[model samples]
Target: MPSVMEMKPLATFFVSHGSPRTLVDETPTTEFYKKIGEYARREGIQGIVWMAAHWETPYDTIEVSSNPNPDKDFVAFVPDEILDWYRSYKINSSPALADRCCGMLKDAGFNASLNSTAIWHQDVMIPLRWMYPDSSTCPPMSLISVNGRFDPYFHLKVGQTLRSLRKEKILLIGTGGGIHNLYTLSWHHIIYYKDTTPRTKPIENFAAAFRESMNESVVRNEGGPGLGRAMCRLLKHPHFLKCNPTPEHFLPMVYAAGGCTSYEDEGSVNAFGGENWEMNTQLNSNFVFGLPKDDTIFLGEGS
Candidate 1:
């Protein structure tokens, strides 16, 4: 097999893993991930470098493990069915790639270190489990921690530091809710919403307005750039706290954004999961920064 260093650069993704309930459904979002996996195989991703918002340590960290399995935390929050689905997945990790990532980050001047820890957040496990289906088939995976500080500039800088790994075909995936604030949305929307048919609640509304603003900010086009503006509006957004009670969920975007080829590098924006967290705050939205094999396709799956 060709080593990761031998392969070409792979794209980075901003994956939205909404409530755990969505994992069992066969939805567009889930199909989007399957196609993404197919795309990754075509690109020869040596291993996965997953940067998750759910896992945060004071210092930048990476997990080194061979044949890893995801840890199901907070299983009691959901139904037995959800827990059963979560328990069915066994994702693998890569120790070699973890070491390489640590070396690269340290050389790049970031406070990087390695641990033999079993770190699996819903953000990391749910998407991959649904996307790959078969755990062993996954490439060697390494876990990267979100910094304690939710500074966009800092995370972006951290992403920039790891850009070199792309040459090794290491995939950088940022997993968390783009509009992640479970506290605001109605529980009925979350617990009751099924994957098929028209959603009981409209995809738009107060939740969508914020998602729209986020959409405009990230998707580059003739309308011009919005990263600068988006960053500014985030704090200003009336539901900013409701959308993001804490920084862990939203910080990954800054890191993902920082790692893109350029601010102008075009990506796709996907808005789903209408379950409003608080005051019409929707835990929806995801983006990707990379060259798509199909120019017409956004993140290998069009919105």
Candidate 2:
């Protein structure tokens, strides 16, 4: 019989890390991150490979966090107890995982490089560090946005390369929001003060549309045309310019999902409880390209 990690199918996820405010809010988004970390601990994952929007590369290079002492300042505001819990856990940042992904891509006739100079200490990872402080030490891999252009075929190719790493029991995580138009949304004002203005309606609509599209992608088991169409519609949405001024942040999730063979719900949590309220949600969205019964990892009960 295969080992537990080997037995479990490879998983992929596209999580909404919300804005930086999530680190300090008593809202749903913060709760969502907490729930996700708890679920991961329960799932018995050896380690997670994060593909975060915060760690963008300038070209086609893949940047791997090879820092001997990865930055921990991202979670400076986290409670001591939470910080201790993470410090006590034995988490490994799998730099080797990054190498594996790069190798796979190179063997498949794709030009890929491993970059270690990139900094990922921004919106997404900062909040993630707070939520999963114990796992913060885990190795992360990043793909740079090619001058703001999104090539679906190239992304799919990267996903295909990532498929090989899943067999080794790495949980691949793609972090970013479905709608990430920071400048236009005025992320600071809305997530903090609870703005109910009608202007924000477009943001809500975009979020709802994103959720629907994700659910559809999971249920349908294929994202090629359907997913692309939904994304295109989002880009054309009137408020698109405000919510996602650029596609770089939004595209990472797509690449993460495209790499998976199958997806499973680990858990879902809601952070706030008001109309037009900010929703910082987390889901143990698991993915496996196409591994047989060789995949079955459970991470605690679903919320």
Candidate 3:
């Protein structure tokens, strides 16, 4: 295998997977993630390294799936059929790759190491496994979470550690949302309405602000303090309290952004889907940071 430094540039994504109940819904979010799988196939991604909100550790650790039965059923959210397929296929869980990522992080003036067990079960993995059932093209790297808190420095270090992997033809995905506060959403309002005319103004406004900040980040190419400020505003949005009671959902995006050498060099950063896809889900925002100017198909329509 090539050195981590030689890996291809990685694409970072900040997606929102609304209500675990949404998983069973045949809506735009499901379609969006499916389309993302297609996009990954076209891009020829060797494997994916995901930072999921569902997974967190008491300490900073990177888990290297080394189960003798690497395919054992670990994620309960996925169907049994998918789990069986994952178990049967012998995907490459390269220890060398994991080591290199950890080493790179340590070399970059940060503390890092690897673990052999999964820290959490990510919802996105469900669609990802379905998209590449063969397992030949969808190997993954699991990062252990540090408590439930969203530690920017720790995540930034994780991204920096994985920097070498990007050049090695791997894709680094930061799976979460820009503004998520489940407490408020689950209690304050409803995401879906019967009439749809008098839509939830609070949610709509929140999504708009989130998109505006993301767009501004892409345009400015170096959002620095502006990004932090925008994120604060997003967190304060009423919907945030309902969508994400904790910061875990929102922090992954920040860490993912910090990993990039520059926004101008990052690949397409966009959301998948969740509620009111046509109205609120900014799926068409093909915002690219650090991606080639000629790459127009970065974000594809839902299948």
RMSD of candidates 1 onward, in order? 4.8, 6.8, 6.0
Q: Whole-model lDDT for model 3 versus the true structure?
A: 0.49
lDDT of 1 by residue, 1-303 (tens): 677556445566677666665566555556657766876877767778877877787644433333244465664345576677668766667677777777877787777777665557687777886667676688878877886454566677666777767767777777776676666565654445532223445645655767766666666421113443354456567766655777777777666655554543435232222222222444545666655434444533435
Scored by Cα lDDT, where does model 1 land? 0.61
Error of 3 at 181 (Å): 2.4
Cα lDDT tens digits, model 2, 220-272, are 44433443344334446564454567766655555665555223222221111
Per-prediction TM-score: 0.77, 0.64, 0.66
Those runs of model 1 whose alpha carbons end farther than 4 Å from true positions after fitting are 1-8, 59-70, 74-85, 188-206, 221-239, 262-280, 292-302
Q: Please identify which of the two predictions, 1 or 3, would achieve the higher lDDT against the true structure.
A: 1
Winner on TM-score between 1 and 2 is 1
Residue 44 lDDT, candidate 1, scale 0-100? 68
Q: Candidate 2: deviation at residue 214, Å?
A: 4.9
* Candidate 2 vs candidate 3, TM-score winner: 3
Q: Which stretches of candidate 3 lie over 4 Å from their true place?
A: 1-8, 21-23, 59-93, 134-137, 144-150, 186-211, 218-243, 263-289, 299-303
